[model samples]
Target: MDKTLHYLFDPLCGWCYGAAPAVSGLLESGGVSLELLPTGLFSGEGARPLDDAFAAYAWSNDQRIERLTGQRFSEKYRDRILGDRRQLFDSGPATVALTAVSLTEPARELEALEAIQHARYVDGNDVISLATLADLLRALGLDDAAAKLSHPDAELLGANQARMSRAQALMREFGARGVPTLIVGSGAKRQLLDHAAAYSNPRALISQLEAA
Candidate 1:
């Protein structure tokens, strides 16, 4: 039977940054297919401005992530992104950008996610703008792919929505409360891996899935 791994996450999530290394490791192993699901966990309809309180909270959380996962939350983002305090903290554009990239070049979906994340979290670029996203995609040699990201008729849009629905269904199926979740099994006997292990070491979680 073909095995698949469903990775539910929101682009603006801080913990997702911490989980990047493990996710990259899982992909590099070539043992499972990762389905990237985008959840708008932060910022709603319109882009919400980033405030001092929000920045402080994010910095605290990011510091914790850095301490635990060894992921660098650069000083540039700390001083620049948060310092500017002018840009909105919206993930919709970035999420849609990934969806666009996925439609044109499915194989590079993860790379796009990583790029966008690095753009926002490290390089301090605003992922909420079409121009910046296009620039990033072009830099990745995915300019044409990025174009499809904004198309109204792209099938990947439906795929992205379906992925979100599947994630929510899994949540209801497993009594999950948030994104960055994991579900193991094929059909009726599936299990939810909601423990801290799922957060820190996705490889261990995948090992558990293999055992299951």
Candidate 2:
């Protein structure tokens, strides 16, 4: 059997951020092949605006996710992003930038994810703009995102869309309800891990996947 795990997540998702440590741990264990599937839960063409009430709701929920997973959602984010007068929280450009990096420099996808996450959840940078994304890419030693944006060979945008399609297929196949989902197995046999407990315990998912 190929000891591989498919990690499906959205870059802007709070739950997915919370799941980072476990996922990172699993990745570091070297026992499984990691295939990241970005879901674009808050990215791409159809992202909704972040209204005041909606922002508050998201922050409260994010607090819970932080508590459970020990992931930090800094006060800087609240004060600088949520409380500030500026109102911009679109994730499309960030996702597209990530897609670009993933294609042109696949080895640094995890670093890109972390940089974006820190920018939003810690530094409170407006990650929706191409300029910000480009700055992050440059900071992380990736190519100049502006150049990549125009590069005809970059297949990340399309690949990101394809990943979303695969995520939908996985959701339907596993009867999942939302993002930050995991399907442990392949073909006709698979185990779904959508709840916090199962997600926190990789061994539980491994057992279920083996049984499946």
Candidate 3:
């Protein structure tokens, strides 16, 4: 059956970035109504500086993700994005930018998310910066989102917080621990599809979801 799929993720999550192809496949199938849930996992208190230790850890994981999903974590990205200690590993700004996209150009939220991920992991752009995010969205013809992101007001900020809270509540309900959680269906018939399949074989989820 075609069901509603709730995808729980964070803007700064590498695995979620790796799942892009799978996400695209799911969309192409035209079999489900996919709802994105931003968890804000790397925002506020979860945010941190890009220190050497964390950089190494992230790089190691990035390599694995690259091998598994073929999503590049370029040397430029490693040097300019992860290698810079001054950069904050916060998803807050990017989340707000996406919130702007969700509000304005609702159809292209995935496009925006993929662009943000590519900027960080492949193109070596600083996605956590408001100015950078604003520019990126504008480039995608999302001028309204870009304008809103340029100066995030209280309403935008509140919406971002509310989105994260709702995602977190869903995670709690499913007893899920992290990002890339896919919960299919709704109400009493909800089911958690194996997230591993998204990384292993992007198209596998279509069959899995069909079976669900």
lDDT for residue 200 in candidate 1, whole number 0-100: 67
Clashing pairs for predicted structure model 2, backbone only: none
> Per-residue lDDT for 110-180 in model 1, tens only?
88888888887888777778778888998999977666664645475677676666666777777777767
Stretches of model 1 off by over 4 angstroms after superposition: 43-47, 150-160, 187-189, 198-203
- By lDDT, the better pick of 1 and 2 is 1
Q: lDDT values of the candidates?
A: 0.74, 0.71, 0.89
What TM-scores do the predictions have? 0.86, 0.84, 0.96
Query: After aligning candidate 1 to the native by TM-score, how far in Å is the CA of 36 from where it should be?
Result: 0.9
1-212, model 2: which lDDT tens digit per residue?
A: 45556677777888877877776665565555666777666664657667788789889998998777778999888887777555656666766777787677776777788889889898888877677778788877787554685453436567768877887788777777776786666555567754465345756555544454
**On residues 154-195, what C-alpha lDDT tens digit does candidate 3 reach at each position?**
988888889899999999998999988998984569888888
Evaluate model 2: give its TM-score.
0.84
